[model samples]
Target: MSSSSTSPGRDSKARAADAKPPMREALVAAAFQLFLERGYEQTTVDDIVALAGVGRRSFFRYFPSKEDVVFPDHERCLADMTAFLAAGTGDEEPVGRVCDAARLVLGLYAENPAFSVQRYRLTKKVPGLRAYELSVVWRYERALAEYLRARFASRRDGNLRADVIAAAVVAAHNNALRSWLRSDGQGDATAAMDHALGLVQSAFGTAPPPPADERPEDVVVVVSRRGAPLWRVVQEIESTLTRD
Candidate 1:
């Protein structure tokens, strides 16, 4: 092991140690680290890029602004939700389908519990981040409503129904997700989501009415004076029961 021979091996090890995380992940990690240490408002994009060992171009490529980094996965998650809803066959129950779609958001949070909990706490402290988060939530709700609108197009008040159901799904999902975050991600998030979404499903997921032929025949009851003639009563009943 001559000194020159050992030099190459040492250099290679140093390179490995110095290698940076993937650019996008690096940006997010650096941003959160700074956000926690120095308040989010105090930390700038330049500081994040400096820590990430990347340029401003790289940071902007991944995130439009500081707030976007706080919620890195939402764009990807929203795209996944859109694709999931678009792939539906239209045969599924709309309310139930929306509830399932809402679960995808829970899955995103559950994928990194510690990170989720950290972000949750951070958002609570920052009113701007909280407002940004609400806007992100509205986008998700809009996606669900759009999908439901197409599914329910023929029904009366279809648009209204779609919007209402979409709101319910979002409300149920957020309720469960925040509960899990508040608990420090301790319990079964999926089960809690299921229970919350189940309520939405139960409230709005009634099966479509049976086909006209499969529906049971309508029954009619005739009310007549006790002294009225039996024939008159029969005539009245027949008229009431007759199909147009």
Candidate 2:
């Protein structure tokens, strides 16, 4: 055979290799498969690397630990949320902006409903994963709170209001998200999220328009000390904000 005749076969082989999954994706696929086949505890990093045909160093390069692999997209999602909050136009209410940030999270899960449901189930069964997930959730909550604090800094109760609204948004979003996950990712998740956010708006949002037959009370927001823990401030603000 001539050299030109062999060129096509070599090019096809090169293209086939180029089209193969990336190392990170291969590791994720191998890890999940092993975790499902053998219980999470039964699987090890070695097994994952072996299945992926990659070395242990390669696995570590992609994921810090086995638990990290379970929730691979968290860092990306958190960055996206932070960016969205940072890009706020200053025209929207703080609560509304926070609600919009929470929607980013919902959109992330909705993009991969099947994987979200499976990962939710796996996390429940693994204590380490549950703890990791909690820490990730707190990161998201903190991002929103930081943005709100800057928005409300001039107000008397700025810090307190920021923490409270942040917690409330996270709580409402989780409640709606968990309900959808529990149902195996069925139904309209966006609709459920809207309803949950509306409740939050009613409780902590700007005062709604009063009926023509009634008078409107002047709304007042009380500020708390800046040195206190976020959770304490959140509790105090929540109790005060939810009052009829």
Candidate 3:
């Protein structure tokens, strides 16, 4: 909802006026600051509004509810993640890319560690916030699943297999990230994420086979070198061919 109703024909200045950091970021920063100062429950939306230098109306325009402030750019993060997945999260080094995306989310917290820590504490104490956060995590997992489904569309299991793989990836990422955040972002978090994902590959029990229909049954021997040393191997093959 905009405070001004100048109408569409009001000219470009009106639009420019409406264009006001995004109000969302401002509210998040304001709320985060208040949470640090007065504590989570002690701080009110009014406090956030006052701190943001915006009216109550503007605050509501940006966030549907007060709890939304804790998430900040969660929607934007999902969009970025979707873009990453679409760009081939299925590289030869898929696990690497998945871990990189995990780092991106972690870095969002690192961008404002103090606020992240505060929010973390609040979320632990607040059931509602905790639930909301978990849902956000699931959104990421679901996106990964859809991406994998698209990447391996030709597989028999297709989306089902993708769902399982995505679940494993998401779990690994969250576990590693939470451990790192608890330790104040210490250690090789990326490596830890990779280690977790490695389990997925091992659990699958086989290397990824060639794409369906790309291989034919039975065998054809092009060249054999069971014994004969070095150059002798080629000589043996030539001799066999000549004798035939």
Compared with the true structure, what per-residue lDDT tens digits does model 2 show for residues 59-163?
876678888999877777888888888787776777888898999999989998988898888888988888999999999999999999999989999999899
Residue range 111-179, candidate 3, lDDT tens digits: 766666667778887788888998999998888778667766898998787788778877877787677
Clashing pairs in 2: 157-223
Residues forming the 10-long window of minimal summed lDDT in candidate 3: 12-21
The local distance difference test score of each candidate is 0.88, 0.85, 0.71
Worst 10 residues of 1 by lDDT: 12-21
What C-alpha lDDT does candidate 1 achieve relative to the native structure? Answer: 0.88
User: Between candidates 2 and 3, which one is better according to lDDT?
Assistant: 2
C-alpha RMSD in Å of predicted model 2 compared with the true structure: 13.7
**Cα lDDT tens digits for candidate 1, 131-165:** 99999999999999999999989999999999999
Cα-based lDDT at residue 174, candidate 1? 94
Cα error, candidate 3, residue 139 (Å): 0.8
Residue pairs in clash, model 3: none
Model 3 spans > 4 angstroms off: 1-26, 37-42, 89-99, 201-244
What is the Å distance of residue 17 in model 1 from its true position? 24
